[model samples]
Target: MSETRVHRADVKTAHQDLHSERGALRGEHPGRSRNPLIKVVDLAWLEFEKPDLDRAEVFARDFGFQIAARTDRELWLRGTFAGSPCMVIRRGRTSRFIGPAFHAPERADLDRLARATGTCVRDTDVPGGGAAVDLLDPSGFPVRVVDCDRALSALPEQRPLLLNSGTDHRRTNATQRPPREPSRIQRLGHVVLETRLFARALDWYLDTLGMIVSDFLFLDGRRDRGPTMAFIRCDRGSVPADHHTLAMHLGPGTGYVHSAYQVTDLDSIAAGGEYLAERGYRRSWGIGRHIQGSQLFDYWRDPDRLMLEHFADGDLFSCDVEPGWAPMSTSGLAQWGPPATRDFLGAGPSPQRIRDVIEALRGDNEMDLTRLLGLLKAANS
Candidate 1:
């Protein structure tokens, strides 16, 4: 498939627009693959390695995940939703993200994928025992496609609260007091990563997993260079899916940025923020509505310094909706809330980050002088 041709007028308009519009200008890279090996159903879970399993489990509970199963070597976390676990943490020498696992709709897809990729389908020891086909993405991130035989039954529901808006008041005699407690996490929504090989990695996901672009963000005055960031979702035909199951951006570093989990509503996010703050966990950024996915998000740092997000009320879309394009800027990140924090942006200069930039510029990857300058300009914008 060829890249979608965008009009000059659309590019000019998108430069000033923060909201995504269908049929907007895109880069030279195509938004999707004409034919893919297998279309993944949804994101299953993320894998991580942490030195202190005890500390990780404590934070996981506070962050609204239930312990599905725990062992001396491993810890599995789950949400209230009826499905697989949300995350798996293994005891390791240091804390780091391992990779992500996607759910395959059928068992045969695993065999097909294994055959196509020349890899064997192996049984996984996760909570809901299943078989998985493992592969590596263009950016060298470990990716697993699993056909889970068993599914976890849904936990007790955490009902949403009735509200009294400006015009409509649903609650008359009942007072509004959301308890200060851990937000009941519903499920894993999406994960964001930064990679030096953005174009190649974007194509790999679209081609390998049958994912499609929901929105594309390009740096201002550099539309010709194509999109530097993409919010990608699964193509579930007529069924609606989350706006972004995965988001990837071009950056000096190649690793996990953050992972988001769905909560009940705005109250859950706010109250959860208070709960975490009281427990001495740092709030990274959020309590804001994002412009891309339209999710009301609140971010927090885990004991290992990994960023996790509590989000609610995100946009969903059917496969028929084409990708939208917009200019990338710090101001365009949210619809309403406090300004994006420097910590959240990774803007604060650190020795390691500086070293990554220097190495990325010197390496053979996409990071060059112009791209680096454009990223700096976008961050400041």
Candidate 2:
């Protein structure tokens, strides 16, 4: 007999509700083609256009990234990972998420992608010298896949300390006080976005990147309308991958929702939150375990108000794992945490958000008034 793990009493109900409502629907496309032009191995970095490079650099440093390289017009930031630069911030008049760079499984994949997409393979101008092919996603997000043979030297990392628990004690007479410093990020875990056409965008990613859906969340009583959000992961064959390397949600605005970076463990997330809070950085939501990926998470706003998350203890899945389906609800997002904040819900009042609402109402898209009202009601409840 196998032992079953139990959750805390406070979060047990929500966790059980999620499991109970996880319908028989697996989000995979049964007829999805087995071969993709190119397979992406991992996420390389994200590109951002911001008005102020100086402010962005400060925030990046405080967020635990070391300056990899910098120029008057651009900045490169790296994590503890061997990747030369995990993030790029370019000077622009307006702040927005440009896109992400994925790692091509092989150098030959670059030529394959370029030829298939009718794009020319070119030398990457990013910090890492490599070959790359850039393509636009269905949602018009920039997607770059790089094939590189070189990487910057890895940075030093603080290994997780031995922990003591009720039944097992790995530490004897030693106190635990995680340093009140920026949590050292291991690498970019995932990025999420909201798109007006969810199904189209979802298919585009699955067909193009050879990614698989890990889970799907549909509106209650409207499963026929399809999933409103999907957690997708790279198809790494027998090797396990993060539950979701990327996710997309149906919303009025087609913009970046947030990007998550991996930290060492729960202590790093909590202590890092304290460091960020002390520096007057805004925390969106956190110190909670998510229902989907089971990651311990903390969210914060960058200087540009872009949401970024520090997560640890995330679930990993093999290719054989089938997608799980559940209803989209605020209670289902987290197993336990402070109630989902408006900022995290994308319901916070903003000029751009207001414009998006107007555009969605006037346009025939997924974010119609009926669905919008349903989301609002869910958030309120």
What is the C-alpha lDDT profile of model 1 across 261-332, one tens digit per residue? Answer: 999999999998999999999999978999998899999999889999999999887776667778899998
Which ten-residue region of model 2 has the weakest summed lDDT?
1-10
Q: Estimate each model's TM-score.
A: 0.94, 0.91
What are the Cα lDDT values of the candidates?
Answer: 0.90, 0.83
lDDT of 2 by residue, 1-381 (tens): 223223233233443345435434454343123676766878888999999999998999889888888999999888897875788999999999999899888888888888899998889867758888899997889999998768988889968979878989899888887789999988899999998888888887778888887788877777776778888888897788998999998888898999999989888888888999999999999889999999999999997889999999998866666666777888888989888888888777899888998998888677887788766766675
For residue 105, give model 1's deviation from the true position in Å.
1.0
Cα shift from native, residue 362, model 2 (Å): 2.4
Could you tell me the TM-score of candidate 1? 0.94
Cα deviation in Å at residue 254, candidate 2? 0.6
In candidate 2, stretches whose alpha carbon ends up further than 4 angstroms from where it belongs are 1-20, 23-33
Clashing residue pairs in candidate 1 (N, C-alpha, C atoms within 3 angstroms): none
| Candidate of highest TM-score | 1
Question: How well does candidate 2 score on lDDT at residue 192?
Answer: 96
- On lDDT, the leading prediction is 1
